[model samples]
Target chain A: MVNYIKLIQNENMKIYRRVGTWIMLSFIVLIPILVSLVVLLAGGDDDTTSWPLIMLESYFLFSLIIIFTVVVSSDTVAGEFSRGTIKLLLIRPWSRSAILLSKYIATMMFALFFTIVAFIVTMLINLALFGSTSDSNDLGGIVSTGIVGWGDVLQYYLYQFVTLIIIVTFGFMMSSAFRSSGLAIGLSIGFLFAGNIITGLFAMADKVWVKYVLFMHLDLTSYMDGGTGPIPSHPMTLGFSLGVLAAYFAIFNLISWTVFRKRDITA
Target chain B: MSQAPIVRLQDVTKVIGKRTIIDRVSFEVRPGEVFGFLGPNGSGKTTTIRMMVGLMGLTSGDIHIGGHSIRTDFPKAIVQVGAIVENPEMYKFLTGYQNLLHYARMNSSITKERIQEAIELVGLQDRIHDKVKKYSLGMRQRLGVAQAIMHRPKLLVLDEPTNGLDPAGIRELRDYLRLLARDEGTAVVVSSHMLSEMELMCDRVAILQKGQIIDVRSIRGESGVGSKPTLEEVQFDVDHPDAALGILEGQGSGRISDGLLTLSSDRAGIAAINRRLVEAGINIYGIRVKTKSLEDQFLEMTGSETIG
Candidate 1:
């Protein structure tokens, strides 16, 4: 267990010591603050809804997180192969699975760190610009009829985090399967947007298998709104979406581990 | 008590796609010995090293390090090994010290003191805190050696370690590797296309050609010097080369060129031929013994395949 932790630390050091990582982290905090400033400058602050309004406005910031997560995770494995550093890492005492697990865990930790930073910065800006109040209906259509509070805000972040986890894991799987970081990042982001469109198209087909598609369950936040997602007639409950996401998480991890462990590292 | 060989390769083979890259190459690296892997380009020296270090899977056979099979028990076997395949690539974003520290964390036995010692051993103490991107190629190579030896592994494997080093750097690396084998009793295995460098550094060398080991020669001639009478080319500069060749005809292999009669003879055979030539009224101007260098021997052994 201690050795595993040391592996994680080593991977984390490799990630955090890069200037690009720091720049990405700074953008995570900076972009949210900039969006809040733009909204305030547009004379949109006097209407003062609630804290959840800032969280809703910060939903776009999650896209930046997605970009950050995809870039970091894509570079984690593929960059090692491209730079030939995988040879050094592979000859160590640890198994390939252990080394890959450390990289995956470190990438997840980076995603979580960006999520937390986005949450805190968004919350602080919202409180400073528009005072926090107990107005239950101020969630601005994000939660249609729920009595939203800090608990709902926390739940919103949780759902977003879960969705981000799926995307990050998908990126990591691509990174492991491909040797080119550009290919991995391009394919991952392309899949992220195209997957939703494909899922929407599948929803119109009236087939039961549409529910099993990966992107159909990516937006766990849709369940928070208490409405049918993608397929209007077929409603997906929170438990069902969680279950679907869990299955994908498992499949992505399985592919990543198998490919990474069996890779020849010839370069 | 007899100690087991530090590294043993038993008929190790690797087949990629439909082609065999390495074919049943086997050798052992005893403790405190510098073993050299000599081969032409595409001759599978790197492939063999890759299999031994577990970078590439072997199609057949097994490699044992410290008595642990690399195929059956990888982690246990790899723990006793340190290797740099082709080039010692590192995270250029991290400082040299940070890179060592990162690698150090992977093994529980590697301590902070050892990391410091490795830095000192590589003579990187002055620039240990600098990022690897700022380091020169030779410095990076030294740092590579430092990381590989930080764990004090029993078997240290290097592939083409002298690729980019200058003369001074190469000499330094040669000295350091010899010191590692001598002081730490570590069995060092290195592969290179530089026959002269291998001749100066390695104690024993294995020559590979077309995915097979054709010969394993001792650089010190320990096996060929005292135990057996090995053939050497002796050139006799004589007053009449044709007459001298006539006098020494059929005794051994002889060829005359430019007033010099060259004979392939052992020490005793050379003495007998010298006496015979003088008695036959052939005045010898000078007799020069042309000891074949490693390059000549390597070309002669590998069918004179050009090394890239």
Candidate 2:
């Protein structure tokens, strides 16, 4: 267990040491402050309705988090192979699975760190610009029939985080299967956007098999928003969406682990 | 050297598609000895080393390190080994000390003092905190060696370790490897096409040709002394080179060139031939021993295949 922790620590150190990682992190913090400054400069109404604005800013920031997570996870394994560092890493006393698991854990930690930083920066800036209020307009009509409050706001971010995990894991799986980080990132982001289109197409079909499609279940927040998901007639519930997401998560990780463990460090 | 074998390859073979990258090659490396691997380009030296280090899978057979099989119990088997497969590729973003620290974390036995000692052993103390991207190739190689020894592994495997080192750096690396073997009792396996460096560094060498073990030669004699003379072309500078060749008629064949008679003979045969030549009234100017180098022997054994 201690050795595993050491491996994770080493991986984290590698990630943090890169200038690119710091730049990405700085962008996470800076983008929200920049946006807040722009809104204030543009002379928007200061009606003390800060929660809704903060949540909106956070939603925008979360999209960036998704992009950053996908990019970082894409680079985690494939970058090692391209750089020939996998040879150095694989010869260690730890198992191959352990080394890969440490990388996954570190990438996840990076995602969490960025999410938290963006959340804090957006909250601080919005509070300074528009002040705090207990109004429930921050729910943003995602929940139509509930007394949406700070709890729902937290749940919204949590749901976004859960969705980001699938994207990150998808990128990670691509990385393990391929040696080019660019290809992984391209495929992952392509999938993220293309999945919605595919889900929309599937929604038009009355076929029962469309319910089992992966992308149709990726947006777990649809259930939180009291919407019937992309397919209105399908009666998508939170439990069912969570179950589907869990299955896809398992499949993604299974593919990543198997491919990473079985890969030969030829380069 | 009666130490137990630290590494053993038993008929290890690797096939990629229809090509056999490594044939049924087998060898053993004992503790506290430096074993050299030599082969021409595309001869499977790196392939074999990769298999030994578990960087590549073997098509058949197994590799046992310290009584653990790599095919079955990889972690247990690999714990005894520290290897740089080809060039030592590290995270260029991290400093040299950070790189060593990262590698040291993989094993529980490696400590802070040991990391410092490895850095000092490799003579990277002054620049240990510099990022690896700022380092020269030789400095990177030194840092590679530092990381490889931090765990005090029972076996150290290095492929082309002296690729970019200057002569002095190579000598320093050689001395450090020797020290590792002698003091830490680590079995060092080094593969290189540099025959001269191999001659000076290795206790014994196994030469490979076309993915097969062609010859295993001891650089130093069995008794560890320079007394036992091997077969070499002894050059004799004589007053009358043609007359000296006539005196050696019944002995091995001889050729005269530039007033020197050259013939293949051991130490005793050279002594006897000299006496016969002197008695036959041929005054000897000088007799020089031209020892057959590893390069010559490698060329002869491998059918003169050029090394890359």
Candidate 3:
């Protein structure tokens, strides 16, 4: 018991102070602002241009979450290694596993926070421009999707938190494996972008196993529609994707800790 | 000898890449003793210190700090030992106080007052509020020293602590270390190639050569009673430094350098050397008594050919 939460707090404070983190957060805010302006200026647009869709599609959606998670996690350990701070951190009384876990937890927290902030800003802008209520039902049958409810938003976010944790854990593993933050970030982003292309290619070829990969089901919105059961129209069950994601998380953490424990802090 | 030892190493050896960096070296640091370790470059000084602090594992050895084995009881041993290998690695973005506080939180027992005391001891009070990235090199070095003693460790290990320091800073560090040994009973192990600094700072010294302890002696006792010419007068010069080995003939140990001979001999025999060299018509331009600084002793013991 190394007071892991305090360690997380310590790491979070370090991240919060950095100019790069602030710039990334600012960019997260900028996206929905820009999207809302475009939607409002083109008034009388289709129902798809509503606030919830803007938030879901442009902010808390898979694309933005992937960007946020990749930035935070890839730089977590890689930046410390480059700055020569890992040696100081490692020589402390804590174990290797505890330190990595702290950074992982902090990255997850940042991802969730960024999502929430983006959601709020999009809601306010949507209300100001379209004179719409923040209720899910008013956001164009988003609540009537028949698979989720207003109260379940927190639970869905929680699951998304877990998914983000899995993704960021792998990012941290790559960070530990690579010395350059650019390479770690690039690899993470590339995987997120390329996984869909690979899945589509495999689906076109009738390869059934692509659905079970962790990359295929990172979208919590899809899970809300089916709830771990196989969607009638989709290829893989939600349970299978969740299982694969859990395995990836475990393997990533194991590899990260093992490498960090043995790494020479020559930098 | 009345008190327990603070740190001890037994048969420590570190091998890297088919080359033995540190041989089977053993020494005990008793409580309240300032033990100076003198050696030339590549003499395995940093390697030995790293093993002592458990920063690196020994190839074949056991290290005990404050009565705990470094391997089996690493937390207990490492908690009682504080070290700065070369330059202390710091979070440049964090203020000095914040950095120490972060390190302090890792150790549950270190108090705020103790951290303050460490900062004050290093004379960094005015700059402790500034970010470390903005601090001068000397200030950073002092902050490094502050961190090392923040926990009041039983043994404080510093490798070349005075490097890059002005003469005044060096003197300040030396005085602070002496105060630590005298007042707080903290064991200090310092490694440096600067012989004159060691001669003034250390009570006893261990001369290391090629990872082996060539000689271990007390500064007071080695010079003999009532100061026999300060260990400087017993030294003499010869014209044919290499050929003087035959002339010395079991009288003393010496080496040749650039057509000049520098040797340490007993008092009466040194007087005999002046007569022999002149009678042999060996042009000895430098016949005055030469002193053995810590550097001279280290080079001679290690038998290294290069000297600055």
Candidate 4:
């Protein structure tokens, strides 16, 4: 188990040591600040509460997070092959599954780290620019952000991160299954956006199977507003959406582990 | 040399896409020796090394390292082995120390002292903190050796380790490998296409040809002093080549060519033939013993196929 953590540490060093990764992270911080600056300088309303404003910015920020995390997750395994370093990594005492697991854990940890950075940065900037929510002694006192409580904002980020985890994991699976990093990145990102379009098309069909589509469950924020899902015609609950996404997360990881452990390391 | 084998391959084979890339190859590498896998291009040297290190799965048969089977007990078996398969490609963004640290972390037992010792062993202490991207190919190869030996594994496998090195770097690596085997009791498996380099470096060489080992023989006399060698080609530079050839005729495998008499004989045979030539009034000025290089035997065995 100690060796496993060290392997993850090695992977993190590889990921964080690169200038490109820091660029991705800096954009994660910079985009939120830029968005908040635009809102402040553009002269919005006086009663702009940070929770709702930050919530809106969170949507944009999470997209950038998805793109960043997808870039990292897709490159984690495939980059080793392209760089010809997989032989160095796999020849160690750990099994192939252990190496693959460590890479997965590291990428997922990177996604979580990016999310936390986005959360802290956006929350602090919006609250400072618009109003200080930290001064509020009561959780329910932020009435200016109408209808939704501050707790719902936290829930919104949590649900958004959960969705990001699923997408990043899908990207990771593509990484392990393909030898080329470019193809893995292209396919996973395409699947991330194309999933919604396909889900929308599936939503129009007069069939019950549309509710179980993986893309339909991605937007868990619909559940935060006490709504069924994107397709309100279907009776999809938060529990059902979570169940579907959970199944996919497992399947993606299964394919990744199976394909990775069986690979010949020909590169 | 009687030390128990550190790694043993028993009919280890690999078949890719219906083509036998390695055909039932078998050999044992003992501790405190430099074992060479000599072959030309497309001879399955890399494939066989890959199988021994478990980078590629075996189609049939098994490999044992430190009494553990690599086929079944891989994680346990691999702990005894440290290898750089084909190339020493590291994370270019990581510094040399970071690169060694990266590999050191893989096996939890390697300490900071071990890392420093490896850095010093490769003589990279001055530039150990520099990023690998700035390193020369020789420096990277040195850093590669540092990482491979970080764990002090019982078996060290290097495939074509001298590929991009200059002559000086090659000699440095050769000395370090020999030192590691002698002082640390490590079994070193090195594969290469350069027959002359192998002859200079290896204590024993297994000539591989077309996915099979044709011969495994000891490198005689070069191991140390007092080690006797078999019949070798000896050339005599004399005043009268014809008279010398006639004197040695039917007594030794002697023939006149290139204005000199070349004979196949051992030290004792050379001494006896020299006495006969001198008795016959043939002035034998110089009796130079020719080391039978593997190149001659390799070319004869493989029909002079090109080698690196």
TM-score of the first chain alone, every candidate: 0.91, 0.91, 0.79, 0.91
Write model 2 residue lDDT over A1-267, tens digit each, in one string: 877899999989988888999898888888878877776777764433556666667777887888888888877788988899989989987888888889999999999999888877877887787666545453335424342345766777788898899899999999999878999999998998899899888888899888888888877667665677657878877777878888999999999998887776788
User: In candidate 2, which residue ranges exceed 4 Å CA deviation?
Assistant: A46-48, A132-149, B222-231, B235-252, B256-261, B265-288, B304-308
lDDT (10s digit) by residue, model 3, range A188-266: 8787677657655555554566566666666555566545432333556656777877888788888988887666455
Alpha carbon lDDT at B145, candidate 2: 87
CAPRI-wise, candidate 4 is: medium
- List TM-score per model, in order: 0.90, 0.90, 0.81, 0.88
lDDT of each: 0.86, 0.85, 0.74, 0.86
Per-residue C-alpha lDDT of model 3 across residues B1-308, encoded as one tens digit per residue = 78878888889988877988788899998888999998888787877887776667777889988888886777788888777777776778789998888778777778999999888888889989999899877888888888788888889889898888899888988998999988989999999989889988898899887788889878756665666543343433555666666766676566665555767665666778878877766666666666566667666767755633
Displacement of the residue B160 alpha carbon in candidate 3, Å: 3.0
Provide the TM-score of chain B versus the true chain B for each model in turn.
0.85, 0.89, 0.79, 0.87
lDDT score for residue A34 of model 4: 92
Off by over 4 Å in 1: A48-53, A134-148, B222-231, B234-288, B304-308
What overall lDDT, based on C-alpha atoms, would model 3 receive against the true structure?
0.74
Q: What DockQ does candidate 4 score? A: 0.67
CAPRI class of candidate 3: acceptable
Alpha-carbon lDDT of model 1? 0.86
**Per-residue lDDT of candidate 4, residues A1-267 (tens digit):** 766788899889889999999998888889889977887787753655566667666777899889888888777889899999999988888889888888888988998898899889988898789774433322234333332455877888899989899988888888889978898889877987898898789888989888878888888887866787878778778888899999999999899889998888889
Local lDDT at B215 for model 4: 90
Give stretches of model 4 more than 4 Å off: A47-52, A132-147, B222-291, B305-308
Residue B278 displacement in candidate 2 (angstroms): 9.3
Q: Candidate 3: which stretches are off by over 4 Å? A: A1-5, A44-52, A55-65, A131-160, A204-212, A227-234, B15-21, B40-42, B207-217, B224-287, B305-308
Tens digits of per-residue lDDT, candidate 1, B42-144, equal 9998888889899999889999998999998998999988888888898999999999998898889998999999999899999999999999999999999
